[model samples]
Target: MTLLFAYTSLYGQTLNYDVIRNDKSMGQTVVKRILKGDELTYHLNTKTELRVIFLFDIEYDLKETFKNGKLISGTGFNTLNGSVQKETQMALKEKFYELVIDGIRTEINETNITESVSEIYFEEPHHSKRVFSAYFGRYLNFEKVGERQYSLTSPDGTNVYTYENGICTKVKVTRDFATFEFILKPESLLAVRNKQITGKTND
Candidate 1:
């Protein structure tokens, strides 16, 4: 499952979310969006650690650059157990998108330039098959289930996203016997932050 925020305003903002599994805090995700001139940059960072018989941890970092609503470049790295396992980079050429995975370059059709789960946050009408998964390194298809709900299916599992005011509030992914959920922090927290900012501005 992917956690994404749709920014309606050009102003920069950062979003924080808590990842949960079995009603317990598993990890957190941080997303930041910045706009400068005609370009928009998005950064996403995720970390998860599970301790059972042995300690297992994973981290994913991604950055995407968009110009005029089209993705121009992307780079990401994935680490498992504190060691980098995979790295990927992509750039849009004149007519095609070049993807390099672990030093291997592959040319992708220009029409399929859309390649990132976070891109769903910028999608129009809230439904599309143009979304991509970096973990799978392929595009996934999605269907709108409700006014503010959508579902995406991949070989690994199905992910359902619920949004509030176009911002993804909850995501549930079910794969076989495991189900994971990630939810936005309470609105009260956000309201408090806004109130503090407003108070400072007035002072």
Candidate 2:
């Protein structure tokens, strides 16, 4: 019997569930944990729309399973893949293993152009947390854009680090179309990461 957790949709009008499959007890989905089966299944319901059975995951890696589906494509964790390293694991226990970074800023050659800068903060991994940050750019000079601006490159130019318990796991960047995969150890996010959106700078 697979373990299951049921959640209401954001609107509260629909229901969602995670389930495990077994041929012996088919069609009677048990709301339990770790169903003794080869695959994991998810179901979602929406108002005024047919309930959808999202893609099934034969393997729990599930990176491809969720990204390939039409209904749940952009829903979650599409651009991160990799495991945390020993260094990161050790760093997590430290009282202050924090990094504050800046994202890419650009300056156009035209007479009137806007240069933008964004700030980012990362903490040593806590128990059961994953943090993912991706940077994209127009050229290799993401680092040279401006003050307080870090380079934003695709996975090829992007580097990922997971720091926990004083150990750091580095994930090399690689592109998968509009997204990349940088799997983080869940225990590494001591605090929530600020997204890369920019705002007006102090004069």
Candidate 3:
């Protein structure tokens, strides 16, 4: 806790979460933030190993840069078994943002792009309508469900996030593979190991 406190006070915050599937620990996700002058950087990565008739590994990485609270660039990569599956890049332009997924490039006409999918780990969304998904190179709609909780729905599936204070404590992901949850380490590590969070469920 001392290290976490120091990190929270100095550079930024480090949130460690245990990836749970069927009440079992599969892997983990680590999120970090660094504040320097007028530039802020957020990084996140996830490692999940499970069996789908056979044993395989999956990983996802993301990095986002913000200058004066405006998104400058963001990139993400998804891999399977150490091989790259998808790569996405978003760079800021004059009045629009240049977004490239795989090798295809597109233009986003939104000015002052701020938040994306990765920022949800550090701050809670009280009235956010949507957040940009770098992996999908699109915007995902956000819906406020219960207190301090919000849901982001995409073509893939719906992801529910629960927050405390101003930080996210839990993320419930409903995907095609299976349903899993990311529980904030140490702080909520014990309370959520047994039961699921009570709130609105996507149907």
lDDT (Cα, tens digit) per residue for candidate 1, span 100-168: 899888877764454467654433224564576555667787787876678999987998877544456
1 against 3, candidate with superior TM-score: 3
Candidate 3: lDDT over CA atoms? 0.80
Task: Rank all candidate structures by their TM-score, best first, as comma-separated numbers.
Answer: 3, 1, 2
The residue ranges of model 1 lying beyond 4 angstroms of the native Cα positions read 1-9, 111-115, 121-125, 187-203
**TM of each candidate vs. truth:** 0.79, 0.16, 0.85
* Cand. 1 TM to true fold: 0.79
Give per-residue CA lDDT, model 3, range 1-203, as digits (tens).
Answer: 96875555556656789999999988999988788888889899999997878877999899999998889998999899999999999999888989898989989888787768778876676555677887877778788888878988888898899876556788999989789999898854433233221111222
Compare candidates 1 and 3 on lDDT and give the better one: 3
Clashing pairs in 3: none
Candidate 2 wrong stretches, greater than 4 Å:
1-76, 79-92, 96-142, 146-151, 154-203
Total clashing residue pairs per candidate? 0, 36, 0
Q: Give the number of the best model, judged by TM-score.
A: 3
User: Lowest summed-lDDT stretch of 10 residues in model 1?
Assistant: 194-203
